[model samples]
Target: MNHHHNPPIHHHTTTTQILKQSTTILINSNHLSTFFLLSFLIFSLRLNVETATHSLTSFIDHDPSIKSLLNRLHLPPSSSNHHSPRVKKPFLQLTRVGTLDDDDFFSGDENPDHRFFDTARNIKKNQTLLFFDCFDHLGFVNYSDNGVRVPELVPSNGKVEFKLSESVGIDEKIDADDIYSENVNEGVEDFLKRFELEHHEMSALLFLLGVLSASYGFAILGFVVTYAWVLGIVFVVVVNDLLKGYKSFVRTLWDGSNLGLKRLSGFIVMRWAIRDALTQLLGVWFFGEIEDQYLFFKIFVRLKLMPFSIVSPWVNGVEKEIYGFLLSWILLDTLVSFVFAVDAWIAMADTRKSVREVVKEGCHLLSLMLHPAINLKLLEGIVCGSFARWVLAGLFGKLFASAFQSFMEVYFMVTWLLYYFSVKSKDANASGVPFGQRELERLLEDVR
Candidate 1:
């Protein structure tokens, strides 16, 4: 047997190192003025949507007929002052149901800080509260629920007493919308008439649509400008400008006027548009199927207590299913992004390569991005960013979501660009040749 030693293929850079480097480079090259400009434009456009939505919501909330209709449909209450309650705060006192041992004592009962949270009126008396000790990673509460309470300033108390209304039975469940309901017997159409926009509201709606269109147009233009600026910074840093990367984006925007080939790296934008269109089509098809399946799954889960149900016992609600759908969507987006990242850079770097060739190489080299370590980290980052966007949108509405998305967009671009660079460097090193020489030889071979 021939004895031979094979060297281990070691990647010098870790995902963390790449992330840190990308962050530093992006911060150095980022233009806050452009970001703020885009944000302001988005904010201005979203203001229209917000106003329109708020106007519609307020109309529905304050209108007795509409409120009655909604109540008949068993929908949740609106977050408007039309149904705001003016109840006095309830008296709270702690009570210990069991005696404490000699070794067990309240450490600091005197002048102890106490806190109380008001729960919804629908809360039943015997409902279970699942508690976890996160600090120790304990799965569930360590103590029993029977004898847990305190008094005015007790520190080591575990139970509380609420001065609830005697009218509410222990097992009685309340509907939050009951107070907002009216005695009207109007039909849906009769109530919908209340939503007919006034002259001013109509004007606002029209203006909103106009502003929304303008915002989208500006967004497309902004995309081109951002690509130009990023390419400029990249070229300036890399000392390569063959694609006229140093050209002023303003002149290109002003002269070419439209999204034409005359603009700097306009073809890449065209590629992106096509890719995005296809991706969106894929999403529509995928999500349509997913929605149908999700509906079926949701119904199946809800019917778990019925005869011959197939769903697992733990699959009680649609929450976990929705998470699964979201995760699948993110994976799809990440994979699509992997291909587009390479394709975009190829289009920017070399116009000589046809679109077909660029796409072919992009798809071919996607395996590089799929390297276990790198892809997992990339997926984690995407998940974090997406989760943050969802949460911010829910809690604070459109403004914060728009701003966060804008920042993440550029940050991810820089990250993928750095990743491409790292992959190229690794390829060059593995081949034991300079990058330019390897490219030249490949081109010559292709020509042959």
Candidate 2:
């Protein structure tokens, strides 16, 4: 006898599931076009093109001062006074709002978390307050466990200050002078001893884990193909860095300062990368295997242009060799990741850090990198972060991936800005003048 079996009845959706579905739909609908456009601009702009901008620029502006401040901050200042200590010092300061338009993604005003809001609210003009870990009042030799360096960024204000203290002090002798000198060394040492203790940068570490995960994944994908592919990826990243003199290829395209110009410039750079990759491939085919080995070494050297290298392994052997190389890569990547964490502080605190200074920071972080515990965490972080990014990409797709990637790219951008800012600050501090209205003009010209 034939028996008819009814298909299993479907269960009704619960309120929670329906809400989640609706929320997901809303997010996708709202941000799909926005992220898609950003991706198009970011990737497409990597190619260089000629662009023209009319006088009708949009009112929205990209004020990196706030974002830079937040990205570089590792912890709350030990002393609240550090927040605006320079207001008392930067006499005759030339100040602007230094605010980003609401539309800019980094603008903290709209964020519910209030973390960036505190930073955005307090920044004065183009100036930022920075704390130091390795240096003390007595400088290098006084490497006190508690030393904190609070350096301030003072922009040009079109006027100069002459220190009359020496002239004024020459005529007046104070009883405190002799006492101050006698106790100066002791005072400095004591200060260092009282400084805040060094600690881990949890936020920066988290950020670095995410970046290194992608870097690790990219490197693995390279292994799956050939080492040459990994070098190609690193080459693209480095080339993007070199092109920052054009300043279009870094950060989210939403800055939109010179939208068309950036797109064209980025497009040109992208073309060069494509051409170079093809040429390298052709050379490998024609010039023999030596081309592959040369390309591998070439990437290693070029990466030195930045403050630090990610230390990917040279995998060209069986299971034993692969395991050895992978272990070395993990150890090295741990140190690299720690340095990256310090870099967040460097980003906002001093946008003008030299590669030499970056090297210095990397050197300091070596102590942390050597710890056995952190070494293990590095491997775990890489695997977890890479998996998270992969799952995210699989779920949300290329647009989301591009947006997330933009955030990491900005971390690198901070170092470049640090190089530029450090120079600008040094010159301005030396000159003692805010270059008048010329200051803003100079920033515009530089970004262009």
Query: CA lDDT, every prediction?
Result: 0.40, 0.31
Which portions of model 2 show Cα errors greater than 4 Å?
Answer: 1-317, 342-352, 359-448
Per-residue lDDT over 1-448 for candidate 2, one digit per residue giving the tens place of the 0 to 100 score: 1112221111112323323332342244433343334434333322111010000011001333323322343222234355543111110111122111233222122323211211111223332232222223222342211122223321212121212223334334323344345445444333223321112333433453354345434433322222122222222232232223222333323233232232223322332343333333322332222223223222222221111112222223334433543454445444454444333333223336664575476445433323422443343355334344567669898446535544333323322222233333334445664322233233334323
* lDDT comparing candidate 1 with the true structure: 0.40
**Each candidate's TM vs. the true structure?**
0.40, 0.23
The parts of candidate 1 lying over 4 Å away from their true place are 1-12, 27-329, 363-373, 376-385, 394-397, 436-448
Model 1 poorest ten-residue lDDT run = 304-313
